[model samples]
Target: MLLPRGVPEAGRLAAFNALVRGDRATVCRAAEVPLLDQVDLLWANGWQPDDVLHHTRVALADAKQRRLVPDLVAADRAGRSTQAIDPRWQQQLDDAGLGDAQARRGWLARWSAREGLEGAQLVLAVLAVVETLRVPPLDFLLPPPGRPDQPLASAASAPDRADPVLVRVRRLLAKAESTEFEAEAATYTAKAQELITRHAIDAALLAANRGRNGEAPTMIRVRVDPPYADIKNVLLNVVAAATRCRVVVLGQVSMTAVMGTASDLAAVEALYTSLLVQGQHALAETARSAPPGARTRSASYRSAFWLAYADRLGERLREVTDHVVAGSTDSDRLLPALQSQADALDAWVTERFGTLGTSPVRGGWDAAGWTQGRLAGDTAKLATGDLRPTRRAIG
Candidate 1:
């Protein structure tokens, strides 16, 4: 089996030999394989029980200072048998002065209490800490003996106290309903602003614009400014509002575009509300169809309903297009007008919404056949129209 490029030859040979011997160490050693190379070798060479066991040991040993130890231990507890050490491996612990049942129990108790562990769970907890802690694995095996004569003072013995800064800040902000603990509040605010700026309101608008230009006839842009500057709630409310708004806007536009007037915007809003109600019904239908505990409620329903809504939106766009074409004073004028609306909508959505591919609502157009024809047609018409006015004035 292939090993990582920089892995020492001796290590590889030892791991390979251990695997051949059907030793657990070999599986642990193999787990030390770099993430990218590990899967390739496992699939390519058909990993055997020995290979898996050796790799697990190597992974545990090499996991010094990484979070992988906890995950590895958890995987072992979850019936991933690769992480099991040989029963004889416990003898090695005894050799290291960790063999005494009382010593093992003491160590397990101390480790678990410190890390909130319990029972056989202590094994995985200890292994996880050993795999990740900066100290040597043997340090856990050899703890400094406690001094019984000088009992340690506990926090319960301390006098009632409070930090001066916290007291001062609380008094200063008492009258200010909007103010919070300055340092902690600032940290949370900064994080919230980062997400908002990164997935800015404008950025989402840009993507919506692109989708509109491509083929989606109806789109909505909703801007929300909360009454209070609660940054945490702002992010949650904005994202939720945007999701609901997109569904409403797209549904409305599809129904109204054929009317050739802005009056459809209001009509579309009503239709959007109706669709949402219909969506609720559809969700119930889906839940009834699924077996109990066979699926997650929120995730499965949200995804299913969104997919259903997207299909409905696409069908409406086609229906609107057909209706407009049949009812138009000029068939040629109708296509150009629709194309223009689409381009303007795309640019607006992208500029206002944010970047493409960032939002889920932005990607369904490719599947709907709106990628090429209408965008090209719209651009060509706009360019020609701009030139016509200038040329006529010159003549």
Candidate 2:
């Protein structure tokens, strides 16, 4: 029987015969192998995780073809069985602290892809996972081939300045805010966001996975003007989270230091800038339409409206982000990488800010304005901030 260096050959022969005989239950015990041995055992048998599952499916199909349920074979060996492969897949998933299959797949695919597994290594990996899952026929649920993550901005992408995508989005937002017709403005701003997102994801996917150095972490400082700067920071958080960036508010100077790969920083920077412009316009429109009943508290009403709008926007952005991260195949690496990058950013921020603090925002609590703000936020140009761009924005 084929075996790797140092792998015991004692009961492996029985495990091998059991494998070929489609007696997974017998092999489960006879193989009595450590969970780690599962992959090596599969390799000795010239099988893969996909093959293991496929083999089971074929055997079941053949049995169904012959109109019979296959008989079970008990293990003839006394090998000690370790963790049950199938149930343990769920256990490893829980150990990783992921919520569901989609999220767990995201974590594994992303981290493994980052390491650039291929050929034999990749096959063994997927197979090792198969042993853990233990449900032979269920291997079809294994994750799809993972793609590398979006790289950090590098000199290759841009020449010591802003990315063209960022510039383009900024231009579109500027046009959107400056234009008179609401429909035309929405179209421009929406397109800008779509373009930037596409540019970021596409560039990451098309590049060679090996020897990629574009993931160097970096920072960008974004300005937040006062009179509701705290609220602005919340809005910035929305963009930052969506773009895979971490934000630190510079309380004293009304500035935000965003940290992430350059590609992400560009997206966060431009998206926040555009959103700020759109938000500014929306707030002004809401404030202008306020009736005289709250005349003395008009300023408070404006502040209230802004705060309320930020609250609504934050909720919406969080929902959108969660959905995207969960559903995306490309995000497997990004999901974990984001956490690591965030930790790095937190360390960087802590060194400077020491003890971070929050400011109290003044009134702007007009119910009418708050309602209008919710409507505005929900119907914003890029609704879920999804990966693909919408064909056109609603007027």
TM-score of each: 0.25, 0.47
Q: For model 1, how does the per-residue alpha-carbon lDDT over 1-395 read when each residue is reduced to its tens digit?
A: 32323689998676545444543333334333332233223323322222223334333543321333323322222332333433323232334322112211122233234444333343333334333222211101111112122221111121112433223323222211132222222222222222222222233334445654222333322221122112212222222222222221212111111111122222233333333333334445546766776442444334433444434343433333343345444555445544564455445445533563323332222222222212211221111122232211111
Residue-level lDDT tens digits of model 2 in 1-395 = 12233556766555444455543333333223333244344423322233333334333323221111000101100111332344323342334322122211133333234446433443344344443334322111122112123232222222224566667766776776776655456556556655655554554444324424235556656667666777778778877776667777643334566776676777677667766777778766654765666542366655656666667666655555555455557776654444554565566556644777666655546666676666656654444443233344422
lDDT of each: 0.30, 0.49
Worst 10 residues of 1 by lDDT: 136-145
Error of 2 at 281 (Å): 2.2
At residue 44, give the lDDT of candidate 1: 31
lDDT for 318 (candidate 2): 57
